[model samples]
Target chain A: MTDQTTNWPDHLTGDAQPLEVGILLYEGHTALDLVGPYTTFALAGMKVHLVAETLDPVVSDDGGMTIAPTTTFDDCPERLDILFVPGGGMVYKPMLDPATIAWLADRGATASYITAVCNGPLVLAAAGLLDGYRVATHWASRDQLARLGVEVSTERVCIDRNRFSGGGVTAGIDFGLTVVAHTLGEKAARFAQLVMEYDPEPPFNAGSPESAGPEIVALRTRFMAEPDTALRNAVSHVLEQRAATSSHPVSDENADPAAGIVND
Target chain B: MTDQTTNWPDHLTGDAQPLEVGILLYEGHTALDLVGPYTTFALAGMKVHLVAETLDPVVSDDGGMTIAPTTTFDDCPERLDILFVPGGGMVYKPMLDPATIAWLADRGATASYITAVCNGPLVLAAAGLLDGYRVATHWASRDQLARLGVEVSTERVCIDRNRFSGGGVTAGIDFGLTVVAHTLGEKAARFAQLVMEYDPEPPFNAGSPESAGPEIVALRTRFMAEPDTALRNAVSHVLEQRAATSSHPVSDENADPAAGIVND
Candidate 1:
């Protein structure tokens, strides 16, 4: 029963109830994308649920490892404080699955905060949840996300109103900390940060395209091509279906105001 | 079949056989500690296996999520290119388990490289693997690790010959990348970095005790006190058992030479 949150200072927790976080899990969802944020939320005394369609295990996109879901979509709490999604190779699979998209749409509508990392925003966009919010996603998927009618930012962590998005895989940690700061206060996030030892020293400076130089960037571009194309094609299909159902939604007036977006 | 490794430039992979990496998993291993490095190894075309005592789902220390192991201690390959362990609250459980220690001792003898992150080094040392090697662990457990007759370092990533270790939780990503650089090549590790978008921008500058400031450091110290004491007691018990079985092994003559250690 003793945990990092066991003797959480009353001043840090204040009157805040433990945030209920529902992280969507599906076939091929990347493990780190979910885990980085999950750790931050869990350590900060948030209730995180790995929400999947069934009780069956969800295999990661990386292959080999599988994570069991804590709750099924049907069994998840009707209202969540945070609705999160993680990106991966087959994110398109979930984007096209009506059941998954419907669940995302339903939960995202009332969730206090909508969050995602990497290509996760694409799934949110597919559900029409990110229509007017500027979000961040993996650099490789930014273009594709823009094609979904979602304004994409290049920052590692982007916050627009209640939408919190992170760029690529590791950015989930930063994104999660930012969310904790917003929800619980900077002190609580700092406590989680210390617990996680978030100080990073990447062996190489190739995390972003601009810094990775030409050769490495070209190689990663080639490597990401197929999956990128698949995601693009899936987004086009979603757009076409949306077009057929309803034309010209998410008006300029509905766009999240410029003041709400935090580029940092 | 097309993965990031598809068409991997011949020069990057060269004549290297895919690395066989076995990451230890137990009931309460931290998810990020495993996933961070697992992502790097998996992306670098390494055959990373989640090894456990049995094939059942292993719950994480943070709670909620459960990861299914790919191989059991009894079934894992006899020799591994890399043997890895992840840190968590209950790392002591594995450190005290004879079957797990025996298996690690068996594998560590011949693994091309032995690696750990966070308090994972304690588990490795408990198995009599890190004896005399300068290793790194979570800052909170550095004192505990040193008690196991292992030389400890404060660096985020420490490399002593074939022993590669890392600091707490998030440091696993950096540790894994370093291992990839040593095994495959720097270019290969760089490619994985780009694939992961490893750039980290912490919302707050409070990851290390040095930067976390005194107040946050105090909070984390208090939060970690119980677990730290438990690990210290476990390490003492392990040393007692080791002393009772074999008196004063790993002598000065057996110490890894100065040239083998990479402080950075």
Candidate 2:
């Protein structure tokens, strides 16, 4: 073990201003998606606020845990350094909620960095924040994101301008570190990684459909059929509203044929 | 992409019984440690209960988040398939609490699988459950575990008999999948992995002291000085009490010289 008394490098010890992070919390959102980044930012001395529609305890999708939100949408700070959204099984609920869409639009417009993990980009896309922007989301939800007019990337973490997104649940950790490296320098991100022991070793190589084989992928498709159907409906609703408000009527050249269709 | 209509293999869709998982929640506990495993097990179809001293919301160590426990210790099931603990900065408080230690001792005696992540093993050691058992804990807390008479292993996840212990905060996810693979079979674990997209790509290669370099390690040590000091004091208190009650007085041959001394 290294000596504990050794002086750290100046880069690692510089006094930096704390970042103001706002993480959105909705009923049935995945806990890991929110907690992964929350842990990373909090460990790096950032002030994180769990923002929700209300201040009540928000229950996760599995109904196994409840997390209390620190601030409500109406009360959250207007100018946030980072505004994040986490995805879950019932992610379509938020995508279809006008209030949630309005909140995302309002906060995302002024936030220095707009971010999401897993299917969270779907919410942002539905709120028109990801219009014509390159984004990443859960592999299973990529079709839905593409349907919403966002250029989807399958990379674990994707960054386009001020918008950052990660694929699936566990990718949030890597995404958080990437954000930290970008905002606070690589040294700060490395220090956070060390403290959290971010080294990973998956016992199996079936984390993705390409590696899990066709059989497992089919099983997941069967399990996710209902949610996929709901997402398709939600995407159609959002697109129709956008088209209706357009001054120019929808035309074959301008309209996307696959806008509402669920790609198999 | 694989066809969504493809039939899933019988081996992947077996009718398996859901495991009952009990996760301990406490004041000042790390959010990621608990949420990592909780998300894994829940996604795998396990019935998870966030067990705590009370049903009220438990505030995390960072003070930015609060998690609600589903069931109190007294109301928890008599026999759980898995009993889990998560570690954090204030882990010593639970280690020193007689009620918490007694509860762990009682539940651990009957639980089919006793497990923990991060410094959680320290509490198990304090309860005398880890006596003579090889365990894994956070690297920084190894000396404290040794003081409790438990043999420490540096592996990220260690399994001695039925006690499963993991390293630092993020190790909970890997440890959870290991437990799932053991109890539910590799197919189930692999499916869970796919669902959560557990593929990790760390932005930095600084997860351990050796990998993080001396400067980063020293920086962490400086940041952790106060917690380390408190942990040493707690270890000393537990050790002195154990020595006073021993009929055979503490001897050089039988006692650990490192006991009550914080190893730097």
Candidate 3:
């Protein structure tokens, strides 16, 4: 058994083979979106790999903080127990990257649970994995996400079948706990929750657009205007390309990476 | 102004100077503890420098994730607006490192605010910076912090003069928002709050000892018992060393780094 699973109960350890989680890392990805869920999974004694396109460091949305990716696309596991994507101010880069979208579509097909937090659902949407699923995204991106032809939920932790997603940046914690509970039982989730001291106390009542009032929401909207527009444009372009190339849809049986690449 | 602050109002830019924040990075530190506050600070238009002993990538408590430090101790700004630390499962390493303590002591003496989240205050207490100050820490480490002669508050975000601290791993978000609210105005904090969607909905009520009840708390306590014991021993040793070396105390007036190092 790995050192990470030594203290956990037998049930949690899965007979000494811990749960393998792959969290996608990309430039401009929000740190909290990744770290929130990563901490919970780590505490749950799961093996997590920060998967990126390259082995080089991945710079987050917040310019200065850079995270070294544990595994690259060429080396990540074929099937992750849980595949997660984190949202960012500029998720369009990854949403439009063919390599990232292909990797997600490939691994996500067999993953036990396909998940995302914040605007991360947008990335999954870009990969066509969350096409008909009800996914949650950052409040600012809900409209843009809806443009991608997916059902958008306003809930914090929206679990629609196997596609579990969360709202906004800080929502990843709530989303992580919910996923843990679903996969590892409520006891384990509650245990991880206490470990993280997941009780939140927001200093202000400006979390949502309704609560933040008009002025603050407008300010944030203005700040997000460019990125929101970029995401919309990227969604439009990806949809057009998907339409152009997918005139003859391939059967799901023959759509695996081992067979042939089928985006839709 | 830098790209990070372009969206912010003129008042926050500080005449084109952003808030210079130095967050100490050490091995075994919790990823969420650092990332939570980092997201907030980044959104607040602050210049955050992840300072470490060296420029090497610092591995977090979660073994797989590694973050590259932005600056080294020698290269860090002499005076920072905020000198912060984040707690971890093995903070005893940094707590006992003389260079870390000395560096914190030197920079902390002049920083406008010396802040920490979770057991991070324990590091400050070890550096002789929190002596006689009221602080907050992870619920599990409150007693250990108090043993170092600092008053411990059970509040999530505890502010005592320039020493601001938070409770546990997830409290860093609250701590960051509180720090931003204190340094900047409520407007900036609220703005950042809305931007990040600070609204939290914990899927589980088991966040604190009280809310988690005795059973889950016991599980967490048992898990933390070993590290808790180590922290106690480290605190005892640091206190003894402080007593032994400070028999003849030099005045703080003459204790600047330019003259000689005076810890305590």
Model 2 chain A weakest 10-residue run by lDDT: A1-10
Error of 3 at B68 (Å): 0.8
Q: Is candidate 1 or candidate 3 better by DockQ?
A: 1
lDDT (tens digit, per residue) of candidate 1 on A1-264: 112233345533444456789999999888888999999989887889999999999999867779998999999999998999999988999999999999999998899899999999989999989978889989878767777768778899988999999999999999999998887778889989998899998988989888888898888777667777788789878877886787664222113223233344
Which residue pairs collide in model 2, if any? none
Q: Give the candidate number with the greatest DockQ.
A: 1
TM-score of each: 0.90, 0.90, 0.90
Q: Candidate 3: which pairs clash?
A: none
Q: Taking the tens digit of each residue's C-alpha lDDT, what string does model 2 give over B189-228?
A: 7888898898899989999888999988988998888878
What CA RMSD would you report for each candidate?
5.5, 6.0, 7.6
Query: How would the docking of model 1 be graded?
Result: medium
Candidate 3, CAPRI quality class derived from DockQ: medium
**What tens digits encode model 2's per-residue C-alpha lDDT throughout A131-222?**
77788888888877877777788889999898999999999999999988777667778888988988888888888888988877887888
Misplaced by over 4 Å in model 3 are A1-8, A11-15, A248-264, B1-8, B11-15, B248-264
Best lDDT among the predictions, by candidate number: 1
Of candidates 2 and 1, the better by DockQ: 1
